[model samples]
Target: MTAQYDNLATLESWNDSFKVSPHELPGERQMRARRVSGFLRARQAELPVVPAQEAASDAASGIADAGRKTAQIEREWVSAQWGLVPRWVKSEKDAKLRAPKLLVALNETVSTTQAFRDAWLAGQRCVIPMQAFYVEDLRGGKPVPTRIARVDGQPMGVAGVWECWKDPQSGAELLSYAILTINANNHALMRRYGHPGSDRRMPVILGEGTYDAWLSARQDKAREFMRAYPANWLLANPVENKKDKKPKGLFD
Candidate 1:
């Protein structure tokens, strides 16, 4: 499964890229593990589990449909869609109308639209738990099929915002989310990636030390945690993409 975003690629099938791991990603384990560096094995102890809370309001969004899903890591990981459906949506068909974007830029949210304001001030915040995310290796400002992960092998927690909507007919509430991004033009690791004209953005990855503060911070206090992760701590590889698409769709 792959989640397309901002015409970019990634390590997990989530976001605007596809994830390929030595270990198949966990389906429902809250204590998820990234693919082991050299081998696929039963290994949960080697990595730390990201502490996440499924949005309190979305616990009942009846979006666990058989055909589509959204990804949100909570007490455990589950197969979910990579898009965020507005809490006001009433149909799957209507969801396509918003042309969901997978990312929400912090600077832009302050005045772009009411939805962003509501999500921000309402504390609709969420985090995408990732082992690694993909970035294009650039040469002449073009994207080369490549992936990136943590050199230290610890999972990265990406900041995000979530919303819940209901199916008009089924009355089932569904939860959808978007990852937060920040400009990375100054970061060596992230600056090295992106296609020509592609936004130089990287997910707002939080360390174990800051997870709770980020998750619980009020709107006015959230920005302090948006800084970029140091570039030297990551690893990049030229793994083949599991599947590629004819760049279509918007971010959600």
Candidate 2:
């Protein structure tokens, strides 16, 4: 599974839906392996101020100004590296080598996995806001990317965990997070994706009402929210290029 996803485009959506403001809105609309946005608890009374980055054409494009905004004491939006970097990492070199391998932590073993166990036990949970996530359908004998999103068109809050790793020599801090995935071997919609003979898995997409609870839930209670989202509530469409509806040799 690629585990790639898209992010919110407007500041209003972040404010109205998630009820938090971003420290720095990600420049890229589609979230990949680098720095991405995440919603987590705020421990400070004051948030930092960054200059707004926008042009006159921003309104025409329907994209909001990339400005720093305040957040509630309970929750805040922060940019974190897509991969999880455990605090125990001895060197920056080791961190880079280990991050890619730790992007998705299995819910079944998160509590025991050394890389994620500390974050899980410490209740460092977060919500990854996304417009949609892409999955590959291999039934046709070749990978075809499919975009799965909520039927209501609202952003999805995928469950995750964050950590702060400090460089021993430079003392610089690296904020990182990882998506928590669950087995989808029996899922109605998700089971249709992934390799046919292998075990299928998907990110834990949290419900609309569980944002705050998920960020603060104890380890035991957090597991209660790891269930699969209803298949009917989601819609899937095969990604197609604008120039051509059908790619050359895709079906041949």
Candidate 3:
């Protein structure tokens, strides 16, 4: 329910903070890295390469350059949309907007309820990568934008559900994702930094140990794992907001 957050950094910084292995990179990151590589290949083909005396060295350097570019593009893309969706979704527009709002609530009652059951049954566990997240805080009479991040400045993953949907009109496929929410564990932080409204729900912050089980455990197990972690495990800080000079980070 709180809105103000301070940690905002590139996903690479987050990866380093959490000690996330390349294999642990979320599916969204892989999709983006592939897209960047694809674009670079297409561009490279369009622009002829110069003949070099050190062909092997040139090839290695070219590969490194491509990786740097891909990493940059991946960072930008992930920063813009780090949230997840169901793999079946064909496009964001084709996704079901009702029930859980993909940006905040993790669809515990709708898609996620089913997704948790399905993922547990299928034994397919997953993780969501987030550098920082925005929340709305009520201040005086207006909402403020707050960026919430880990205290150690690590990128964190909230439990998530992805859905893939097909467009009936274009027949294109799209993938979307949602975050799960539960009652706030940090009441003091919620009152001091969260939205002033009575609604104080928060995204379920999963521990590293529980992530795999939450992603791949059976339905019963996943449900048990969905419980919230201790409030002290998370650190909330005040962030700047432009809407109000003294505005808490809650709204734009």
Candidate 4:
């Protein structure tokens, strides 16, 4: 989408707004964390999820038996470590070294800006699955937490890039990924969500029915998938999070 007034003028604005990607500073990640929300704290039950692969497989099968088998099976939610550790990383410690460069991008390969330029061109595309994301309301000065979700309430599939990094030291491999971002300074939803310190930016939430295209699309056409999701299709609710009571500091 073109500049929405919620824009920061740059194609990729640092998420200066209170809105933060679950992957961003994903503090205290797990060896395996449920893709379903609330895995962070024991506040709810994990839900049976329809894995995107199964859905695609069912659609592609066309065979009656395959369809029947798919109908009888339910996929569990995905469990992935938060935050991206690049393919070249040697260990968690090493990945942390690259996080500042690989964690997120304004838009992968756009204007050759992202550090993962070669990987992006090689079609190292992935999707981040989420129920809802949190953002801070900075407009009022003091930060207020807000939960943001699709108005339709379906899980969001955010655009991202992924790669496999093998540790030269131990031959162990790690899979990591990062969310793509885009300017949203003029967006009805985002402009209203962030504080002046970080207003008008957001992740590149993909459009409905675009998941497969994102994964399989050729690199030259990949940027086509970077379009901004409309703000009206989303809603933000003010919420509370006392678990980490540390008062947020500037540049947090």
Return the TM-score for each candidate structure. Answer: 0.61, 0.82, 0.54, 0.61
All candidates' lDDT scores?
A: 0.51, 0.78, 0.42, 0.52
**Number of colliding residue pairs in each model:** 25, 0, 37, 15
> lDDT per residue, candidate 2, 113-193, as tens digits?
999999999878888888899999999997788999999999888889899999999999999999999999999999999
**Model 4 lDDT tens row, 1-252:** 211112122212212221223333333222122111211111123323445666456445532322212122221222233345556554667665665455466673433754566557656666665556666776677777777778976656677665566777778666565667777777778777654656366777776445544555434446766666787899888776686467678348
Candidate 4 total steric clashes: 15
Each model's Cα RMSD = 14.1, 11.8, 15.0, 13.0
Candidate with maximal TM-score: 2
The candidate, 2 or 4, that scores higher on lDDT is 2
lDDT of candidate 3? 0.42
lDDT of the structure predicted as candidate 1: 0.51
**Consecutive 10-residue window with the lowest summed lDDT within model 3:** 34-43
Model 2 ranges off by over 4 Å: 42-73, 241-252
Residue 8 lDDT in candidate 2: 83
Q: Model 4, which residues run further than 4 Å from truth?
A: 1-80, 90-92, 108-114, 195-199, 241-252
Candidate 3 per-residue lDDT over residues 19-98, each given as its tens digit: 33332233343322111100000011122233344433433553222211221111111212223344444454535443
Clashes of 3: 37
